[model samples]
Target: MNVLIAMDSFKGALSSERAGKALERGILRTSGHQTTVCSVADGGEGSVHALAACVKGEYKTWQCRDAFHQRITVRTLLFKEGESLCCAVEAADIFGLHNCEVSSATAATASTYGLGELLNQLHGHAIHKVLLFLGGTITTDGGLGVLQGLGIRLYDQMGNVLPDDCNPLFAFDHWDEEAFQTVRKKLGDMKLLVGCDVCAPLYGKEGCVLTYSAQKGANAMQMHKLEQQLHLLEQRSARNLMQEGCGAGGGCAAGLHILGAELTFGYELINRYVRLEQRLHTADLVITGEGQMNHQTLQGKLPIRIAQAAKKEGIPVLAVCGQREVDCIALTTYFQGIFTIQQGIYPLHEALAHTEEYLEETGYQLMRLITMTAGISHTVLKNQKVTIAEELCRKGKTI
Candidate 1:
């Protein structure tokens, strides 16, 4: 049997490339299944690696400053000419919380201006298509800094231009679009694709500001104030364009949406760019997992999506995870089997540090179960291939 091993890693944890290959090797040796390893990243940390593999793009490294003004070396993608892919990058990877401390909220002020810098360089290269990866952001303010970097100006209540920093949230009055006007004016056919995981709007229960602000060091009061500021920004932004991904990355998604960016699932976007379904069709089985496979996993996480896709082809999917809080019945409907890495009671830290070993063992054990159920292999038939009335997104083909 043929199989594909695809997995997504947690932030600051395993790399998808490593996890995919590890599962592939384990399945091939233990289950006698011919396997292919396909690494996937969902616009979080390993996104650069995933995109590089997908388009066979080259990595170009350069020195840049973090959110704290500390100099660091960073790598960006270089796709071929006429590729038409715009890469929307979140500044968090460069100004990650772990990378720097928030001495003052103002310390989180690098601006995606670096993103504009990348765009300028790409424009010189004659590139038009853009894929914006929005994740792991450190800023809690509305994306004014990014707009500033792109050459837009922010004005205060008095109509005086405000400075770039966290304080703009309080003093901002309106946007000046002169900077990004060049991008629009120069590239008539330019397209912006935003990679986002959250569906929350700009400011509310699920909005980016209230939900993610604390993680960026906002206190309860600060969170409240930031949420109010973003809410206003969202209202102003909504006046122009429909709120598409407003809830993504602290309303950064909303900001981009207003700027005429199209929103797509980060994983799904990567899947299309890489022809993920074509790879799935070639596999006999599929092994996929994430850090925690719970109820939320069913809500558009990479592993669940991969399982759903494979199921349409009658390919058995095995999910191996670090832990699971949801029952297996619901998950088993999509997966051939679901197993956790933890054997008994153990701290989460212990499990993460030994993720490689636990994952290998769990995969090997799953192979044994598949072997025993050879007689009941027909159970895999539970999810028979049904004709999807719409286009086959996996194949990039319209049915």
Candidate 2:
């Protein structure tokens, strides 16, 4: 049996490469089974690393500001597709939720200005295309900060320029398009592709503010404020607020769309670059997993996308996660089996620390089960054939 293992990053525990390698180690323990490990991500955290591994790219470090206006260095993946120079940027590395303490104040103030600054820096690099992964961001600023970083000036109702380091949605009155047009011209013919997983619109009940703000640390009152501010921005800008994925990264997608970006599924984009379909064709079984399996996994997450693709080729898919939510039974429709790596109850920190070990054990056990089941199935079929032959002989004798 040939097994293709493509595991996503385990967030704080292990990277995609490390996780896949660990699972590979255990799978190899079982004799006569071939295994292939692929580095993969869903365009969230660690997406750039995954892309870099897939395409053999180099990392270019750039100085930028974090969500809280703190100076930090971010690594951008630089690679070539044909003769065109392309770059991949993970939004989470700039303003991701994991970088800060989640609080109402942080949610209110986190900005994507640094992302804009990064893009501006890329403009001088002669990049032919930019793939911006817009997941795991903590900001709810509606991309006002991003526009500001791109030289577009935002003004308050009093006609004062709003600071770019903070969320501008609440005080935004209007923006000057002249500077933005100039910047746009500077990026002439460079395609900007925004990758996201969610399908939420820009505002209203199913939009960014209502669906994701709380997790970003907004309280009830803050959620209400953010919602109203998003609505106000929608009205002021007159952009298509109802567009699918416009609400991703807290309306960052909408802002980038205004700047002429094409929105696409993060998983699909990565798969294309990695040629996952071609890799899956040779596998007898495909195994993909994430750190956690839950309701969010249903929202076009990486593992689900992998399973969907594998299912098309009639390959059975399995998933192994550190934990599994009781309510994510729907995942079974795609996966032949879902296994958790945890062996016993432990502290969260301990569990995270032992993720690789647990994964190895799980992989070993799964392979053992598959081997045993194959033998049992063969025996059962043989027994059935023998019984049929005996019954036919008995009928012949009676005749």
- Point to the candidate with the largest lDDT: 2
- Tens-place lDDT per residue, model 1, 1-399, is 566788887555588887776666556557445667787866656776777776756666655545544556666676754635444354456645542445336423434444544545555665577677776666655656556645678887788987754445656667776655654565445667787755556777666656666666666766677777776786666553224356665566666665666787778777776677888766666778887777646546678778878877776677777778765457767765566777678776676677777667776766665555342232233344322211122334321
Error of 2 at 325 (Å): 1.8
Estimate the TM-score for candidate 2. 0.89
Off by more than 4 A, model 1: 81-92, 96-113, 158-160, 177-189, 239-244, 294-299, 326-337, 343-350, 373-399
Model 1 residue 218 distance off true place after TM-score fit, in angstroms: 2.8
**Which stretch of 10 consecutive residues in model 2 shows the poorest summed lDDT?**
381-390
Global lDDT of each candidate: 0.63, 0.82
Q: What are the TM-scores, per candidate, against the unseen true structure?
A: 0.80, 0.89
Residue pairs of candidate 2 with colliding backbone atoms: none
